[model samples]
Target: MDAFNLAKQRYADLGVDVEKSLQTLAATPVSLQCWQGDDVGGFENAGGALTGGIAATGNYPGKARGPAELRADLDLALSLIPGSHRVNVHASYAELGGQKVDRDAYTIEHFAGWVDWAKQRGLGLDFNPTCFSHPLSADGFTLSHHDEAVRKFWIRHGIACRKIAGEMGRRLGKTVITNFWMPDGFKDTPVNRRAYRERMEQSLDEIFAVAIDQQCNRDALESKLFGVGFESCTIGSHEFYMGYTMKNKKVLCLDAGHFHPTETLADKISSVLQFLPEILLHVSRGVRWDSDHVVALDDQTRALMEEIVRGDYLSRVHIGMDFFDASINRIMAWVIGARNTQKALLLALIEPRDRLRKLEAEGDYSTRLALLEEAKSLPFGAIWDEFCRRNNTPVGVAWIPTVKDYEKKVLSARK
Candidate 1:
């Protein structure tokens, strides 16, 4: 028998259907972040270094300088990755045609090109408000600024982005999830913490009050424990967004790298779903800090996927990539991160959870533990290769040559 056939029988013995797992993985969509191609440096003329307590290291060659090149890179990356997916965009990445437009003034016209592109590919679109890397946000505040005018400016931007997202969804025939993640916090200890949070609360309310149809656009708030400069305190802490999401009945985004090193975001999935209707997950690799690194098929990623599948919360959870690594080939980084994410999900889908649950019910902890370890040794690689073959994507290291060739032909032309 072929390797995949043998592995299929092995999984069948454990009461897991291999074909059903593949079908599930094929249907689930992972929203690919647009910033990865340009290292969070959007094509906006509002030029400045990366701010809002974030940085993408390394000066890799062939970085996408404009919308056309970014789209081209994405086309290649998407071709290599298996399964259909969505593309996530930040407001700063709008195609303005050299026209000067500030954040608050942004409209769907700026992103009509993106909507057109997604429509052609039958892909869904997601959006963010781009609350960092601007003169107004240089003081480390956007939505929660001490200045009421500054807060109002950001609030308008948020409302405008939501309208654009609605249009994107309506045009594409898929719901576009708009995630609001602002880098508003203090570098030092603040004498008044509640005041800033209160301001943030009011700002969020004003932004969300201008609601469009949920089918066209849904809202989500992402929280961060701390960033590089804002180490002392983050106004949008986990507890803050938790309360806000629960009360407002909005989707909550749980970034894997946004919490402390000891806190696994996988643990928060089941807990948050109790109150909120759904969740938006930011799948990123944080090395010590929120140092957005390329994702690999590691234990953390596996555990995260396992939790979603085991709890039967796949439909309720929206998965999206949130890492950027300029240290490597930008295209390669995108492929590696995205492919690993899907691979981890495939592993999670193929897991014999029913047997494990039954073993747990019977208090066969020792057998359950032994079987879990043994299951990991199965020929999962064969199944994964077969999946790639079925999807017409390159198997194993076969895709690497395509990236290198693209780098030589397309990337090398960029200077």
Candidate 2:
């Protein structure tokens, strides 16, 4: 407490309100990805390999096999994470009865169990339309496929997901962000990229034809540079989605791992906010490509959050986790990625943005640079520790042993 108090005074001298930063961070919610627990394997009972750009590379034992087990594991992860939070669910993760239910035909009844589970924990929910890992999408063309039947199949699935998301949000009294990302492209350079993008645009329009209230469900469109097999041409490229999102006034999801290796989203947030009302961010780490590695407190992430806070666009941005690392303890992976995300946001929030901006506006570049470098040495760890302590979550390494104990008792016993 004494250390935190001293750190608070130091930041206060720079015109940064430490209490306001903590309050704002506590109110912010970071959405957790559910696929990290079971390596993108959902409860659909669909015995098929993960196709599309998705692949969780690890044979870690004690993976959750069903909804009950997955929820139990999530419960433990959320307990360790500080601040308000929500869970992001892919359509494939729906908890349905033993009977087979196709994706296009799915309804909210299939996910009522998930809503009830979230309600019990006072956690909000976000959703995704799973457009991969099914026979319909096995050809690596869905929504953008030339075949009308194939395109319509994925189109219906997307529409159904929007309806489900609306209901989930209505029940929870929070807007559920339904994001659409498809693995539709060609392995080799296609002669007709226009046709595929045209089909995709049409499909998206039809899926969003039904007007769900923005308060009930918000929509996001995600784009990718390339994927595993479709390295030559990705139909839904960044330019395509950016143009579409601007025209339609929908949220554009800028995933950290979805761009070129050298590019960072910190440079794009303010650019998009100029036209789009709001945007969604999928925080992930990419190794050369979109490998979906666990997120860390790296420079790219810190810069991204700094842009959001410095631009005062935090309220206009919805942040969600998109990485899935199956190589380590899944529960621990969740805690590490989520906590680091919170840490990055806190680091950005604690910056003396007003003073920095004043210096920059006054043409005092040298002093701005000096202050920025000096601020990097500030006691951010103390503020973070105090945040965790106030949230009643385990501070630092204290939560790690709980995960190990859960693995030994609950996870190991799984056959």
Clashing pairs in 2: none
Candidate 1 per-residue lDDT, tens place, 183-269, comes to 988899998999999999999999999969999999999999898799998999999999999999999999988999999788889
Model 2 Cα lDDT, one tens digit per residue, 243-289: 99998888999999999998868999999999999999999999888
lDDT of each: 0.91, 0.93
Q: What stretches of model 2 exceed 4 Å from their correct place?
A: none
Each prediction's TM-score versus the true structure: 0.98, 0.99
State the local distance difference test value for candidate 1: 0.91
Which 10-residue window in model 2 sums to the lowest lDDT? 45-54
Model 1, residue 158: what's the lDDT? 96
TM-score of candidate 2 relative to the true fold: 0.99
